[model samples]
Target: MNGTEEIGCCGAYCGTCREYLKTCKGCKPGYLDGSRDQSRAKCRMKKCCLTRGHITCGDCGEYESCETIQSFLSHPGYKYGKYRQALEFIRAHGHAAFLNAAKHWTNAYGRYPEQDP
Candidate 1:
């Protein structure tokens, strides 16, 4: 993670989101690059991770049953369940491996297909 690689705390690749290209830079602290948009800044998952000192929700013990997480996962935007999948990948492997998986992931808008997640 170069610190600007927009991978959200929930594991959704912000890089693949159209809104991210237009606004966000990645998941670094807001002061680092000021890339977090209003929505990103308000994200519950992000808040949870930051408060818990975690880089992602995969590091949380309650991720699977978390109501906040489940609610976010139910959003219609992720019809493909990419967030859930990415979290699973991160937990099973690691953030680096999850990033590698995101590099090859073609389902999410294909924004950074050439970059290493």
Candidate 2:
């Protein structure tokens, strides 16, 4: 793990996303590779957090009301409930702790073993 996997700015676990090793390196690079959806590189949620100098929206003071994050989470295509769980865990336990726990679970394609059926 590159240690960048657990801290996706909008709360998804890059370590567990199919794009992690192939197309994306998570929000920290601002989706620099452009292999996923090209528009994802311009994600408002990631841009908002980075522009504010935050590691993740969970680190932000206004995370709850941040329209960008709220909209992302509300998208019907957003199926990762673990994203919210990861955010809460990060907020309560810290990023390092989340990373350590996540390390045991990420599969090659980047989805957790238990999550993929």
lDDT of 2 by residue, 1-117 (tens): 257534677666666667765776667653334444534456787767766777678889887787777667666653445566667667877777667677776542123323221
- Report residue 64 deviation for candidate 2 (angstroms): 1.4
- For candidate 2, which ten residues in a row score worst on lDDT? 108-117
Q: Rate the local accuracy (lDDT) of all candidates.
A: 0.64, 0.64
Q: What would the per-residue lDDT of candidate 1 be over residues 3-116, giving only the tens digit for each residue?
A: 324667777676556655456544544623445453456667776776776777877999878889878877887543777777776687777766665666554523222334
- TM-score per prediction, in order, is 0.66, 0.67
Please give the distance, in angstroms, between residue 78's alpha carbon in candidate 1 and its true position after superposition: 4.2
Against the true structure, candidate 1 has what lDDT?
0.64
- The reply for model 2, stretches above 4 Å from the true place, is 16-18, 30-41, 107-117
Predicted structure with the largest TM-score when compared to the true one: 2
What would the C-alpha RMSD of candidate 1 be, to one decimal place?
Answer: 5.7
